[model samples]
Target: MSKHSVVIFVSQRNSLRSILAQACLAHLGSGRFLALSCGWPGMLADAIHPAAIGALNSASMPIPNHRPRDWNDLARPSAARAEFVITLDETTSSFQPRWPGQPDSALWAFPDVAAAGDPEKVAHLAIQMLYALRRRLELFVSLPLQGTDRAAIRSDLRDLAHMR
Candidate 1:
C-alpha cells in the first residue's frame, strides 16, 4: 500500500494563514496527504487566532486541536519527515529551514491578516485567505503525485502560487 505524502505549511505565526492551509489540506487531501503546520522559531503565537477559528467554523472546516508550534520542533530527528514544505507568508518564505529529506518547498505568499485591528476586517481577511487556500489545496490534491519526479512536483506546486 502507498503511504500518504506529508505536507507542512509554514508562516511567521501559525495563528492564521498556515493554520488555514493546514486545515484545508487535511480536509481536501482525502487520505492521500498528511498535513501539519508551524511557525518560525521564537515567533510562535500563544494560540490560533480567534479570527482564524471563526473562519474555519464559518466554512465548517475542522479546527486544529493544538497550539501554534515552533518550526524547530519539526526539525528534530524523531519528527515526521515532510514530502513538501510550503511557506504561507513572505517572512517565512525568506527564512525557511532545511528539511530532513530536502522536501520540495514553495512560497504561497498570503498576507498577514493578524495585522488588522478591526475585528470585522480581520474576519473578512481570514475568510478570504481560507477560500484562497482552499482553492490552491483543491488543485494541489489533484496533482499526479505517485509517478511524478521531485522536480516536477516542485514545479507544479510553485506554479500554483501564481494563481489568484
Candidate 2:
C-alpha cells in the first residue's frame, strides 16, 4: 500500500514557508509520504520568493516549479485527499475547509520571512524555516504510523508546530 499523504497550507501568497515545507518533506520523506501545498486566494504572488529558491539551492534540493496555487485547485473531484493537513500560518489555520475526511491538521506559525525588508534577513529566515520543517518532518516520518498511537502522533506534531 502507498504511504499517507500530507498537505501544507499557507494563507495569502503561496511563495515562501508553505512552499518550503512542501519541498522539504518531499525531499526528506523519500516516498514515505506525498507532500502538496496550497494557499488562500488572497494576494497572489507572481512567483516563488527568491530567498526560498536560494535556500533550496543551498540545501542542494531542486526547486519545484515556481507556481502558486490555491487550495481549490487541488481539491478537485479526483485528487488524493490528504491524511495530514499542516497550516504554516495563523491565518490559514483559522480558514478551515471541508476536507473530505476531515484529516488530522496542525498549525505551525512561522514568521513571514519573505516579507522581511533585508535580503540577508530573508535568507536567514528561509534557512531557519527549511531546517525547522526538516526536523518536524523527520519526526513525522519516523512515527509508528500503522500502530494505534494517533493521539501521541497528534501531540508530537502539535508540540513541533509550537516550537519557537
Candidate 3:
C-alpha cells in the first residue's frame, strides 16, 4: 500500500471539525496514513475546542491540547510533504492555505456551528456536520489506486461505519 500524508488546514485549532478530523484519521488509519492539522499564519496554540473534544471523547477518540501550527514549521526539512491537502471551511477564503508538493486539494465547505459558544447550539450545529463528514470521508479515503470498484468501496464504507 502507498503511504499517504495529508495536511489538513483550518482557521483555528480550537474547534470541532478540524480536531475531529485529525483525531478520527489518526485513530482509524494510523499506520496507513499520516495526518496533521494547521491554521492560517498566526493562529495560536490553544486549548482544544470544548465541544469538539467532548464530541471526540464521547466517540472514544479524545485528543487533547492540540497546538495550532503553520506551513513554515510544516515545510521545515524534516517534515514529510503532504500528498494531499484538504481545507475545511464554510467559506472558501476563511483560512490561508499553501499546498505542498503541488498536491491535490479541495476546499470542502463545512459548517463551524460548533465554534466557542453555547453548548446546545454548538452541538446541534457542529456534531451534525461531523456525522456528515464521517459518512462522506469513509468513502473518500477508501479509494484504492487502480481499478478500485465504487460499489465495493461503498459497501466497505457502510460496514466500517457500523463497526465504528
Candidate 4:
C-alpha cells in the first residue's frame, strides 16, 4: 500500500473544522495516510474547539490534542510533508502558502459551523462534517497512488467534497 501525507487547511481559526479533519483523517486513514492542519495567520487558540473534541470522543475516534497552527507553522521542514493539500475553506487566495512539493490540492468547504450557531448546534455540524469526511478519506486511502490515475483521483476528491 502506498502511504501518503496530507495537509488540511481552513482559512482562519484552525480551532474548529480544520483540526477536526486532521484528527479524523489520522484515524480514518489507518496508517495508510498521515495528516496535519493549518490556518491563516492570526491569533490562534491554545486549544481546539470543545465541540470538535466532543464529536470525536462521541464517535470513539481518538481526540487529538491539536494546537491551532498558522501557515508558516506548516512550512517548516520538520512539519509533515503532504502529497495532497485539502483546503476546508474557499478563501484559498487569501492565505495559501508554499509547501516543499506541489501537492495535489482541493477545496472542501463545509458550512462554517462556528458562524452558524450555539455550542450545541456547532457540535451537531461537526458530526455531520465528520461523517462526510470519513467516507472520503476512506476512499482516498484506498486509491492507487502509484498508478497514472491522478486525474481520476482529483476528480473523485472534488466530487467527494460536495457530498452532504
Top candidate (lDDT)? 1
Q: Write down the lDDT that model 3 would get.
A: 0.58
TM-score of each: 0.96, 0.90, 0.73, 0.87
Off-target runs (Cα >4 Å) in candidate 3 are 90-97, 146-164
Instruction: Give lDDT tens digits, candidate 3, residues 1-164.
Output: 24564545454443556677776777666456677766555554455666776677667865835565655666555667775556675443444545445555555566667554788778666666666666656655666733566456435533443322
- Top of the candidates by TM-score: 1
Per-residue lDDT over 1-164 for candidate 1, one digit per residue giving the tens place of the 0 to 100 score: 14899899999989999999999999898888889999998888999999999999999999998899988888777888998999988877767667888788988888888898899999999999999999899999999998778688889999999999
List the candidate 4 regions with Cα displacement exceeding 4 Å.
none
C-alpha RMSD in Å of predicted model 4 compared with the true structure: 2.2
Q: At residue 46, what lDDT does model 2 achieve?
A: 77
TM-score ranking, best first? 1, 2, 4, 3
Per-residue error (Å), model 1, residue 109: 0.4
RMSD of 2: 1.8
Q: List CA RMSD, all candidates.
A: 1.3, 1.8, 5.7, 2.2
Q: Give the Cα lDDT of each candidate.
A: 0.89, 0.77, 0.58, 0.74
Off by over 4 Å in 2: none
